[model samples]
Target: MPQEPVFHRYVALGDSFSEGVGDPDPTRPNGLRGWADRVAEELARRDADFGYANLAVRGRLLGPIVDEQLDAAIAMEPDLVTIYAGGNDLMRPRVDLDALAARYDEAIGKLTATGATVLMWTAFDAGWSAVFGKLRGRSAIYNELVREVADRHGATLVDFWRFGEYQDLRMWDWDRLHMSTPGHQNMAIRVLGTLGAPHRIEMDSLGPDLPTDKASRRRADLAWTKDFLVPWVGRRVRGSSSGDGVSAKRPTLAPIS
Candidate 1:
């Protein structure tokens, strides 16, 4: 059997997905304890020197994410790194996928050249969500680009685009944009498994089914549209972002405990 890999330092880069927006935890930084944090916590249990830093900020576009976080992550000299970007950019009315791919490829090349075990994720398939379904074709194209970049760089690929488990409504947060607690937990398990690392993390039970009645569903949808969708659209219109005044929750690597 192959020996399990050991990672002493781990750095996560990207936007809300990497930052853990949907998994709320008032006690943690940014009031969130996302999948990346969960992964770091588990890795910490396996190594005495494990340190982690997450530079992801919600609402950041691909350009700002790379400009702000890439060099900082490289400077940390982490043995393991995970990045999930471009989803925010895809949501825009227009995007130059070709140009975006070039930048993504370049960033991956730099991260890989550092000799770290880099992990990359394709955007999840959102065809089930009425709100995000429109971006399905664009997201698919970007996912393909991500695959090619990962192949060229030899980065571990976590194909989120194929996670059929996310088709379940419970796997998403109320906003329909980020993952729920169970979703984040599932991702942590996937990441560790890809690294060939043993972990005790398990998927949390989705205890009960949500109401399926048409009237009940309509009420819920209206509430979500009012509470989340409208504000999101307003932000786009105003050229603002949720992350505009937010700083990275974990800007430096330190022991998880």
Candidate 2:
């Protein structure tokens, strides 16, 4: 019989998704708690000395993440690392897929070289959303490249793209851009299961009933544009990002709850 592996140090890297944007938890660091943190909590249960950190920030594109977070993560030498990136870039109009793939591959190579268990995730298929339907082609390409990179580096792949559960509207937030609290909970369950960790994470509800009528749905969409999409587009137009002054939520290694 093989002894179970225990990871003492775990670090997470990425953007809003990894930063736990939709899942608001005032008690947690950065006033948010996502799947990565949840996974850390489980890891902590397994290893008494486990320490965890998250270097993810919101509204970050792949360039800054590769430039800013990867080096810090490599320096920490965590026994386990989870990287969920490239989604933000894919949302943009003129993204260079090849460059993103190259950078991602390089990051995976360097991280795996540290002899740690590197985990990577693919962006969920956006086939359910009209706004993102056009980009599904691009997203698929990126996912394939990521799959290849993971295979090359022998990194663990958390296959989010194939998860059909996200097709449910309840899996997304009001803006339909980020995952809601339940969505985050679902992701935590997926990540822990992928790692073969013992966990008891279950989403509380399917979510509050949303409008199913066309008029009501359209009204909701318009409100979403006014409240969230417009401002997001304006920020990008000005070359500003939501992560501007933000730093990593958990930059240093410390005991996880």
Candidate 3:
């Protein structure tokens, strides 16, 4: 029988998705506690010596993520690594999917070469959202490339694009771009399950009862457009980002407290 795998050092990389943008926690660094942190907590339970580092920053594009995080993560010599990037790039109006994937593939190759168990996530399908529906084709292309990259690198793929659970509006934050707290919980469950690691994290498989009336739903959509979408578009137009002044929440590997 094969002995169970044990990971002592785990590092997370990428953008808002890995940074836990939608999952707010005042007590945690960067005022967020995302699925990556939850997965670390579970791994810590399994191994008392486990240490975790999260180098994700919100509103980052693929190039910056690779330029800023890839080398640093390698230097840590982690036993496990998780990366979810390129989503922000896909959202841009003009992105060369092929070029993007090349960079991502290079990063994954470097990470896997370190003899660490690497994990990757596909961009979630956004065809269900009116706000992001137009980018469905682009996202699909990116997801396919991501699948190919994971295969090439022998990395664990989270397959976020195929996860139908995200179809429910409740899985997303008000911005419709990030996962909510419950959504993060769901993702943590998925990641741990994929790793074949025993975890005690709770999974809420049920969808919430959302308002069905057209008028009510319309009102909510309009409010969201005004409160979130408009500002996001404005930022893009000004070449600004929400992460302008931010740094990695956890830049060093340390035991989970």
**TM of each candidate vs. truth:** 0.98, 0.96, 0.97
Instruction: Please name the candidate that would achieve the greatest lDDT relative to the true structure.
Output: 1
Provide backbone clash counts, one per model: 0, 0, 0
lDDT of 2 by residue, 70-142 (tens): 9899899898999988999998889999999999999999999999999999888888777788899999999
Clashes of 2: 0
- Report lDDT (Cα) of residue 64, candidate 1: 91
Error of 1 at 45 (Å): 1.7
For candidate 1, what is the total of clashing residue pairs?
Answer: 0
Looking at model 2, which ten-residue stretch has the lowest summed lDDT?
1-10
Candidate 1 stretches with Cα past 4 Å from truth are none
lDDT of 1 by residue, 1-257 (tens): 99988899999999999999899999998999989999998889889989999999999999998999999999999999999999999999999999999999999999999999999999999998887999999999999999999999898899998889999989988888899999999999989888898888878897699899999999999999999999999999999999999999999999885
Winning model by TM-score = 1
Q: What is the C-alpha RMSD of each candidate to the true structure, in Å?
A: 0.9, 1.3, 1.4
Q: lDDT for model 1, please.
A: 0.93
**Native-structure RMSD, model 2:** 1.3
Model 3 misplacement above 4 A = 1-3, 204-208
